[model samples]
Target: MPLILDALCLARDDAPVRRLIDALGTEPVETTERRIGEPAVLSQHLLFGSGGEIVLHDDAVVAVILHLAPTPSAPRGLDAAEWLPGVDNDATFADFKATFDVPWRFADGDRYFVLEAAYLRPEFVKHGGRRAGDLQRVAFTVDDPRETCRPADEDCPVCRELIVRTGDGSFDLDGTVDALVAGVEAGVLKESSGAVSLADLRLLHASALMERVESQVTCTACGRVACLTLYRDAPPTFGYHPLDAAMRRPLEAIPPVEEWGDAARIAEVRDAMRYVDHEPGLWFLVEQHGDLYLDSRYTISSMADDSCLIRLDEAERQEYHEAGRDSLTELARRIDRSGPHREASPFHRRNLLRHPDEGRDYSAEVRAAIAGHTWLARQKQAAAQRAQAGSAADG
Candidate 1:
């Protein structure tokens, strides 16, 4: 006799857990207090006649364990009068609450403000620690206030030279001989004349006198401090930094989870997942003739959405057998493509035979790679469609 067993762990009030229980329909037989070890990790669990158990950890429902077999030892006698007769419902852990609220996810210490790319709730505190409120509409602009601490002497040659040269409003000086001299005299270049070069000035503005402002906010409840940082008067080294939008865009506020419910939470999760780029299984995308092919050393396959599995060609298959020695005994030694057995050129599709065996079951590697590639392409297309829809709505 053979048996199939499956178990799923979930939060007490999770929707899926409720759905599974409702689907099973059968009433649990006995609810008992179970303990483990000497000091004992203790919990209450429900044992059903169907060989299923619902384990509750610390008043919060955690795991639903199920065991099924054609013939198996019976669980302890189902003698209890009621199944989960009394369950405590008031155990909402802080970590669980934080999962639904994005602001709470990043909050550290006593402050509760969100400053991420999507949402910007400037309010520094959760509403008396109950729930997050709407974003305060605070509008401000960034401009260099043009304040710099200078030596009391009005005619500092370095400052005068920099201002004169940059009078034409160009901050595009590479840290060459002239730039180095200005940096050294202005005390921005800490290392001696010989040590620092063009690389050292990579982070600094070329003209070197960029104005910046920094402000700190204290948490209303615990008096903890957080900084509100802004930059100004910086020249573009090559092109614009994508991070500049952090200041430019008005940050929206994430509402409390209780307000979002399941539907809205799923929407948020789906939106967030668009930004993730999962790595496909390790396999080379090779070009054979004019068509793209995927090979995982053990097997070769096509790049089409519905192509069937194909094993390595006869010549390459012979290489795999010969390189592994006549009996395949020296397999590991030959699999290391770094040594004398290495292929002459990596670009050629035939050179894919030099790749090490990835411990996959036959053509399973190619199958998984194709599946992942297909899924990634679908995700990108869907994200683009959503972006287009959003732009049209805004227009």
Candidate 2:
């Protein structure tokens, strides 16, 4: 089985291709040239380092560079697709990432190209007399991991207490009920005689009440923000938290920073922030690690960092989420304002808009996210009152 790495060809010229080839430290051992399709599909297969090859496929117009290692014995190969097949129990992503110390990073002059690594293994099924296998991705975009990282086994006192109280493997319904009743008392919820459901109090839990049965909290010691989600199967444990709508716009504007350890790092880089909302930020889990990292973007003070609460927006949040990706940067790279962009076919346009298409309307999303904030709510109220006054004057 071989490994494959496929990156969307970003550059207008062949500079990125040449840089990648140079970085991999291999030259073409065998070159196979072919063309297909109505407009002639021009492609070149350049074999390198025993079984490794770089395939440059063009629509005779735009091209994509594919890196492949077609044999299992080939060094530093991933079983990505049908071309490269590996056993299901072969080397895992962590195993490869731990040892493969090649310079995967490529830079042409000032421009740096970051390649997201994907590791795959082949899954096999036995036919009547023959065995067949297909490549299945086991891991995608695995980071260059830091080996020393380990999870702390002990939970904080609050979490430990919650686990103890709910050790019978049942959700704390009584506590949830009490929290709802309190919301009514605090004028945050409508008065109801009948029993209140958890479903009805989702917004209340996301907004007014912080310390509730199913609530979110950030650990002071480790700076991990976790949501106390309702679980029936096991003792109450915090799962991956979600970002509330109100906090999403603020999060989107904050610039990406390297992993910060303490509050001081946030303070240092705080002033350069574009969006600085007082409400709690989103909880972010560290990639491939058990520890939770709060998205305390542009938090000026350590006090604000600790005080800020995160409301998990369950509607939009999904698993396998990629954080800190600048979609506009990707959009700009794909769309060519110069050169033969106007002459490019509709097929090429679709390819360019694939990832960043829906993401382009992100400003609208940001505006919608902040639409429910207190300031916006007040503004809407004022506008409504002014409209009423104008109608009265006309009458």
Candidate 3:
């Protein structure tokens, strides 16, 4: 008999984890669009760390699902359970909460939480630390803040005692601890088929999960950080650099996960990702020491062409202006001088004409040569036209 398997994104780049993909039976990615002509979504997910948050639910665990077959597609963004039990009666995450009554999912840390029951035996903290007990089963979910909500000076999620706003900007527990439990109970959160064993988890966790950009930039207007973007021509010798928006400082408020590995690196990467919009096909400008850089990183794209185009925000424009000295006028000058005006030949006199009255410098010899060439070329064309006309008349 075949064993049941769980699915997840292995690399989410060009290569999917062979074992993980194989567990899915190597099915070519199947895309479904909610509407026609809209991009279809791929759902191959790459899961890391124990899935859940500490304060119960706000969505902290970083897991990514992507498209695999038929050449990489965007995610559909729809899940089976809108709320526990398929999204119908679920309490409002904006202000509602779902219950994790007993026999419920990991209650301690989950929301809209999925599984009703699961036990990872002999559970140890991400780091080798105080055993949080035999990892006996647990339940968690995004409980409704209604009961917890009371008329206080500030009734907002941030100010409310039990309610906290989620990354998606809804009031809920700290993380989506509740959501995971809800998915499991609702039969949406299936276990990974090629489930990584506990030992494997620790080993992989120790390794660096991703690459880091030493440099980054910030949007002065929005106070949003910009992640790295890729371009054929960028600064710092034409390579990618970290954008300030991608930079993150220690988040004092969000609950911390006690997973294994150098917490420092995880923290660093997490900070970078937080500022990154992570929308498909997005790129940001990197600013460093009077130079602007584009990072050719493949983040969240189904098919990340090594040569990808990026959307720029104001911060990036300023960085390029400061570093590359690239304003409209400067760019025009460079294009004319470096790209199309390298030779002084009359044929290549350049498109932008300098006005003699303006006293813009120009070579007298080059100018005279160009004038002569223009006269000669025009006469040749005119003579050809006259000869053609004469031949027609004779015929």
Task: Report the lDDT tens digits of candidate 2 across residue range 260-351.
Answer: 22355444434221222322233221111221111212222445421111222232223213432332222222232322123452223332
Q: What's the lDDT for candidate 3?
A: 0.26
> Using TM-score as the measure, which candidate wins?
2
What is the Cα-based lDDT of residue 107 in candidate 1?
A: 21
Off-target runs (Cα >4 Å) in candidate 3 are 1-62, 65-79, 82-91, 94-215, 219-224, 227-395
Q: Give lDDT per model, in order.
A: 0.31, 0.31, 0.26
Model 3: lowest-lDDT 10 consecutive positions: 236-245
* Model 1 superposed RMSD (Cα): 27.6
Indicate the residue-level lDDT of 150 in model 2: 8
Q: lDDT value for candidate 2?
A: 0.31
